[model samples]
Target: MQNLTTKLLAAAALVAVAGCAKKAPEQLPPPPPTETTPAPETSQPTGPVGSTVVPGSKEDFLQQVGSDRVLFATDQYDLSGEARATLDSQAAWLAKYPNVRITIEGHADERGTREYNLALGDRRANSAKNYLATKIDAGRISTVSYGKERPEVAGSDEGAWAQNRRAVTVVITGM
Candidate 1:
């Protein structure tokens, strides 16, 4: 009689548990789509007369100035006529944006020793910086020589060396 009572109690507990179990939630309908306006074009040139779009912007400077770098003659830190012209344009652009600060990176070909190349690169960077100082504030510019450590082109050929020996103007901030 005790076993029969125990079985009945166990069956009642199971029935209660089954009855208390949660049911699955009903599915919700998908949200309706909404219309969106087309985004404005950013690549178009829309600046002052004879100037590129967004004068103080980096993209405008790159497009108007042709390149941010100037190549140097072998073993020389002097600015060539072409380099001077490029820097002239750069100076104009920098003048237009007084808030811009820059770093001049000096580089050299792979022919020289690491220490020698580093020194050469420093001279190259300083040369460019000095020229730019006449145009922009000296305080806004800094210099660093990568030497032969970072070459624009690899290998020891004249072609690669020509590309490697260069000073590059990089916009640091406020542009």
Candidate 2:
């Protein structure tokens, strides 16, 4: 009888543990929203605009400005092929206007040390600026590292990290 009770208790414990085990569902992010509204007008384009869209022109540039188009790799300043492809469009716009100068703003997420992130952001911005300048004159390009000072997504996940690693082109003026 004692042996039978011990076996029953062991079986119950096993069942309890098995019942407690559960597999969490995978995390699925939502799709980006569509932009249907027309952008606000600012001024005429001064320099070259992107092939798909103009850059020097205020309205055309608005397609990307203050937008989360730019993307980067995790803990990396090197421009990935995907990133270069995206920048390719920006370069096209920069080429359209010779007088237009741009500042490549490098930004990072808040996952690392602040100083490290700042330096990383600077490197990222410079990397983008370097790539673009290679196609044009270095004088037309400038870079700044915002570090993790500002986060576009503002979260502690791969989703936010991806958004943070970016080099944005800020159009200063048209030529």
Candidate 3:
């Protein structure tokens, strides 16, 4: 009698446990489709031969020239052959737009003390600025050094460092 009572209780508990099991949730309705508006079309304006459509504009300068900056070798302030070529093109662009003013920003890789790197970057910027002065009015260009504060790429590797060491010619006004 005792064994039968225990068995009955066990069966009742099993049924109770089974009843508490979870059931699948009902499915929700799908979301409605979203409507999007078409973007306005923008075209690049054409300019006369040897002139930019938007003279002194950063976009025009970058488009007409290969790049707005010249990369430097590690820890070096001297301009390389390629750097010279790029600066030469930048000078010609500056010459074409006589009213344009530029700021030469010098940057250094993250391998030196803040003070040292700042000085190095200053030298780099001045190097580029001095070179550009030969082609355009010296008064049209200014120089600033960011040291390692603003890096083009973020990494400790040589590839990233190489990119960080650069002098960028930025159009400040007259665009």
Candidate 4:
């Protein structure tokens, strides 16, 4: 009789545990919405395609000033007439955006010692900075020399070297 009672109790406990267990439905509900989820039809872009350039942004600067860099002759920091024209456009853009601050990055081709290249880069950056100072506030400009450490193009040929030796005006702070 005691064994019979034990078996009955065990069966009752198993039934209770099985009733407590959750059973999944044949189909699951959809997942929660996420940040990357597409917006509703009302939230779609209305402007012309590629007309979404934000004001005072880097893209706007590039669009307004054609190019941000000026190429230099090998081992020279002086601005050619073409370089000056490019700087003039850059200055015009800066003038339009009064809250902008810029850094002129001087770069050199891989031809000289590291120390010499760095110095040349500094001179190149300064030359561009000084020119921009005449149009924009001198306080808003800064210079950095990467020398041959950061090249736009990497090669031993003149074509690559010509592209690498340049001063690039970058927007450091903006609206």
Best by lDDT: 4
Tell me the whole-model lDDT of each prediction, alpha carbons only.
Answer: 0.84, 0.74, 0.84, 0.85
* Model 1 residue 173 lDDT score: 38
Clashes of each: 0, 9, 0, 0
lDDT of 2 by residue, 62-143 (tens): 5643341467778888878877777777776556666666778899988889999999999888888778877888897888
lDDT of 1 by residue, 1-175 (tens): 9999999999999999999998886976876543222123334453566764454556656766768999999999999999988899899877766776778999999986999999999999999999999988999899999999998988879999999999999876332
What's the residue-level lDDT of 131 in candidate 3? 93
Poorest lDDT segment (10 consecutive residues) of candidate 3: 35-44
lDDT of 3 by residue, 86-172 (tens): 999998777767766789999999999999999989999999999999889999899999999999999999999999999999976
Per-residue lDDT value at 136 in model 2? 82
Better of 1 and 2 by lDDT: 1
Off by over 4 Å in 1: 1-54
Q: lDDT of candidate 2?
A: 0.74
Highest TM-score scorer: 4
Give me the displacement of residue 116 in model 4, in angstroms: 0.4
Output the lDDT of residue 7, model 1. Answer: 100
